[model samples]
Target: MFKAVINVNYKPSVLDPQAEAIHKALGRLGDDNIATVMVGKYFELTLNAPTIEAANDQVERICDQLLANVNMETYRFTVTPLQGATA
Candidate 1:
C-alpha cells in the first residue's frame, strides 16, 4: 500500500482572510518575528496501488477533482510506500 500526504492552499494571487487574521492576532500577541501566516488544508490517504506511479496518479486525480479548487487553489502531494503493506 501507499500513503499520500496532500496539501491544498490558495494561489498567491488569492487573498486568505483566515491567514491574515491569524497573522494579525500573532502580532497582537507579541510575535513580531513571524513575517507571514498561511492557512491550508492537509489530508492523509492510503491507497491500494501496486506502484508509486499509480499512487501518484490517484492522488493527483483526487486533488484535482475534489480537494482543491482549480480556479482559486493549488495542491501538492507526496506518495510513499507503507511499511510491510501490500497492494
Candidate 2:
C-alpha cells in the first residue's frame, strides 16, 4: 500500500478571487502587511498497487488527466509506502 499526496495551486500570474477576499478581510482586521493570497486544493489518497513505481505513474496520470487542469493549474505529488511494506 502507498499513500499519495497531491497538491494543486493556481499560477502566480493569475488572480485568485478567494485570496483577494481573504486579503481584504485581513486588512480590515488591521493586518495590512499581507499583500496576496492564493487558494488551492489538497488530496490524500491511499492506493493499493503492485509496485511503488507503477503506482506513482498511475497517480501522476490521474492527476494530469482529471485532478488538475494542465492549462490553468499546476499539481505536484509525493508517494510513500507504509511501514515494512515492500514496493
Candidate 3:
C-alpha cells in the first residue's frame, strides 16, 4: 500500500480572494508582520499500488484530472509506502 499527500494551490499569477481576505483579517488582528497569506487544499490518499512509482503515477493523474484546476491552479504530491499495510 502507499500513501499520497497532495497539495493544490492557485497559480502565482492567479488572484486568491480567500488568501486576500485572510491577509486583511490578520492585519485587523494586529499581525502586521505577516507578508502574505496563501490558502490551499490538502488531501491524503491511500492507494493499493504495489510500488512507489505506481503510487506516484496514480497521484499525478488524480491531481490533474480532479483535484486541481490546471488553468488557474497547480498541484504537488508525495507518495510513500505505507508501513505494514496490505494492497
Best lDDT goes to which candidate?
A: 1
> Which is the better candidate, 2 or 3, if ranked by lDDT?
3
lDDT value for model 3: 0.92
Q: Which 10 successive residues of model 3 have the least lDDT summed?
A: 78-87
Cα RMSD to the true fold for all candidates: 0.9, 1.4, 1.0
lDDT of 1 by residue, 1-87 (tens): 999999999999999999999999999999978997889999999999988999999899999999999899999999999999966
- Give residue 68's error in model 2 in angstroms: 0.5
What are the per-residue Cα lDDT tens digits for candidate 2 across 1-87?
A: 899999998877777789899999999999999977778999998888888898899899999999998888899999999787775
List clashing residue pairs in candidate 1.
none
TM-score per candidate = 0.95, 0.89, 0.95
Q: In order, what lDDT does every prediction score?
A: 0.93, 0.89, 0.92
For model 2, give the 10-residue run with minimal summed lDDT: 10-19
Candidate 3 residues 1-87, lDDT tens each?
998999999999999999999999999999989998889999999899977888899899999999999999999999888889875
Candidate 1 Cα deviation (angstroms), residue 65: 0.4
For model 1 the local lDDT of residue 41 reads 99
